[model samples]
Target: MNTNDLKIFEAVAAHGSFTKAAEATFTVQSNVTARIKSLEEEFGVELFTRTSRKVALTTAGETLMQYCKKINHLIDEAKYDIKNAGQIIGQLKIGCIETTMALKAPEIINYFAENYPDVDLEFRSAMRSTLISEVLNFKLDAAFVSAPVSQPELDQIHIRDEQLVIVSSAQTAKISEVLNKQPVKIIVFDQGCIFRARLESWLSAKGIIKYKSIVLNSLEGIINFVEAGLGITILPAEVMEHYYAGRKLIAFPLNKELGTMTTVLIYRKDVPPSRALQVFADMHKVQG
Candidate 1:
């Protein structure tokens, strides 16, 4: 019922473990359990279903989570308004896809830190789908994601264009050569990645349907695998250059239609951005 209790609940929901939530909140497991129990009793509904391994939110808990996000966001806004008044000083949580985080985010983060020392910045690197979901759920202030985001509740700003490339080992002379290898091993990020989806589509168009998939979460890992001739992957040209520097890999430019993708900054359209977010977004506009 209280803000403190709700914060604990949110932490537990996010971490999906009572012990982990306690550690994140700087408390003990017993206190976290008591608070959650008290809330459940007060609401006459079970908030979480506990198992031997992890905890999951119940139906009532899911409904409360939506309101909890709004409430927490409002609380943050109120504190920012009172403490900073008209100043552009507050916390800005930004999310970015792995490629953009590697290639584009450093300059913007450096500039924001240098100019706005009073503002706190929290940056997260995630897949395109995860970034979009976090922004929509109020977990992030804004996010840099791949374009073609069709969420009706989100507003977007075109940040920059990235040229996509098919990357393979130095031994591979042509794109077709890599594809012709039996059981074409396609290394990529998880299923939610936009680049992976594009790569799959391109392969399908070439009548490739039975390629072996190797999922690696780390960008560096993917690059390393491609260099070792374990598999091929699609990535941004700038990213490949920055990471590999043409040391042991070959990058072939995709066709114009599939090669070019826009990285966009997206935020909730219904909510007005805080002063800090507004100023940060304007900086990107000026840079773009």
Candidate 2:
């Protein structure tokens, strides 16, 4: 019932485990357990069902946890707003896809840093879905994710549309000729990658099936795999310019109707905007 108890319950629900949630909240497992137990006692309802290996939320837990997330977010936002009202001197954590680091990150960070030297910035790069989740969970103040994010709680602002180009080794011209060829290695990032989903759907539409693949966690790994003639990959044109400059990779267009991949800035709409986030969001409003 208390804010501390609700915070503990929220952490447990988000992580789906007591031990993991304890680590995340910088507390011990016993404290997390006691807090949740106190909360359940006060509510006269069992919030979570305990199994030997996993924790599952009961109906009451699910409903309560949803509201807890909102309450916790509000508390954090209020603190951020109060502390940063007149100055910009707090740590701002933003998340992004790995490719965003190449050029866009430097330009944006340099501009922000030079203008507001007191505000410390931290950029965490990961798969797009992970970034989206972090923003939703309040772990990140904001995130730049490949767009079409349909989550109701998050507000998304379109930044730029980057072309998704299919690239193959130049020496393997025959691979380009046959859209549904054998020995096709689809080099892709892990599950949460936006382009990886796009490429799979594209292949399905073209009736190209049974292709080989290599799962890589980083942009550079995918690029290296493709450059070594190990496979072909799809990537945003703007972000991949350096990799394409003198490589044996040949770029091909996805059909025009497929459209460009959209880069978007997403943050919780209901949360009071932090000074750091407000400044960052303002930069996305491209002047005509």
Candidate 3:
């Protein structure tokens, strides 16, 4: 199939709906359908299982998607090499954990944008696990994640260390008082969040195995709930201070073990970084 057809295929696979894919690719739904149909017919395989609501990739489609990612990545590299000629003038996709996005990313992003006016910058906020997975899958060029990442397929550069603390409402005199409160509600993000895991571990160590988990996706939501005395949460000290300024919340330092976490920028080791990605990484490296 031609590169244009594969590009449409990738968009459809990513969006999971031909109409949405068409909108993303600036084409009509009929053109997207025709391109996908042509590819399926050429391969003699049903690429996607169609449904009224949305489409799911078939086995053949999944295999094709992997190759499409590699092809797109290579094409991006070629464009950077030929057109930019070592200048930082390509799209840079970056991912970050929510806390980092809230506290640390703005200054770095602003600096990068000012310095590399030609680079198109895109950012996604996700948990550390999701960020790492996205970078490994080529969905992101790089990500800011909780450090101590041991994945051999990835290379990491230390960005900064975050001191974590147990945060509770101002009415609570001590962290123990908050823990001793009846029902012991813990405000947290969904599963696979590193800070949530650390909070759980600390709770379990204190013989608190039974507690109500109040799951909220946004950092503001969690902090607001905690400030309202609904539950307690663990967050970066800087994050709590930066947002709330310690006015409504009391921060309790954790023990040396769970008290600190490092934020590191990670990227896939196998892919040669584009000039944009390399320059971004170097900026952080110089800062560190």
Candidate 4:
């Protein structure tokens, strides 16, 4: 019925166990059960299907959960807008792809730190698809991703151009040479990586169909594998140039359709823009 009751409901729904929710909220199990009973009585509906070991939200509960998130978000927003009147405050959740994190994320964070020190900033790194999904769901205020994002509910800014290149351990080998001479093993990030998808599409189009692949979750792991003569990978050129230079790795260019990507910052259209996010986006427009 109130914010405290909603918080208890959210915790229980999240953990799916009365005792776990009590532990998370630092309350007793009896208090959690009492609150849920009161809420269910008020609504005259069962919110959860509970068994000894698990809990699942009923249809009514799921509906309440959506409103609960929106209400909680609005409450937080109101608090921030009032407490930091005409100033940037509160925490911002930002996201980036691995390549951007390695290349320019530091400077980006520094820009925010110098400008809005009061705003607590959190940065998360993930593949492009994951970043987009997080932003769309309001989990992230904004994210940096490989561009041409076609989401209807989101607005985006073109951050900069990034050049992707194929690197191999063969110091002077060309793309043609690598394709012709051996069974190329592609080292790439996990399934949701945009660069990996691009590389796969390009190679498939070129009729380089018979190749092996190894999925490395870390950028460093991919680079290490490529440097060790284990496989080849496609990465942002600036990343390799700035961090992994002079490593006997040969960079080969691809056609524009495959090699060039526009980096973009994206956020949801429905959410009211935060001050910190507005400044960060504006900075890229002015300085990028």
Per-model TM values vs. the true structure: 0.77, 0.81, 0.78, 0.82
Ten-residue segment with the worst summed lDDT in candidate 4? Answer: 170-179
The superposed Cα distance between candidate 3 and the true structure at residue 158, in angstroms, equals 1.3
Model 2: residues with Cα > 4 Å off, grouped in runs: 7-46, 50-56, 178-181
Residue-wise C-alpha lDDT for candidate 2, range 75-94, written one tens digit per residue: 87788768667886677888
Error of 2 at 179 (Å): 4.1
Residue-level lDDT tens digits of model 4 in 150-211: 98988888888888898888654666766775677899988889989988988898888888
Better candidate by TM-score, 1 or 2 = 2
Which residue pairs in candidate 4 collide? none
Error of 4 at 36 (Å): 4.6
Query: Candidate 3: deviation at residue 200, Å?
Result: 0.7
Which is the winner by lDDT between candidate 1 and candidate 2?
1
For candidate 1, the lDDT comes to 0.89
Return the lDDT, model 4, position 41: 99
lDDT digits (tens) for residues 48-107 of candidate 3: 999999998999999898778878888878975997575768688899988888776688
lDDT of each: 0.89, 0.80, 0.89, 0.85
Best by TM-score: 4
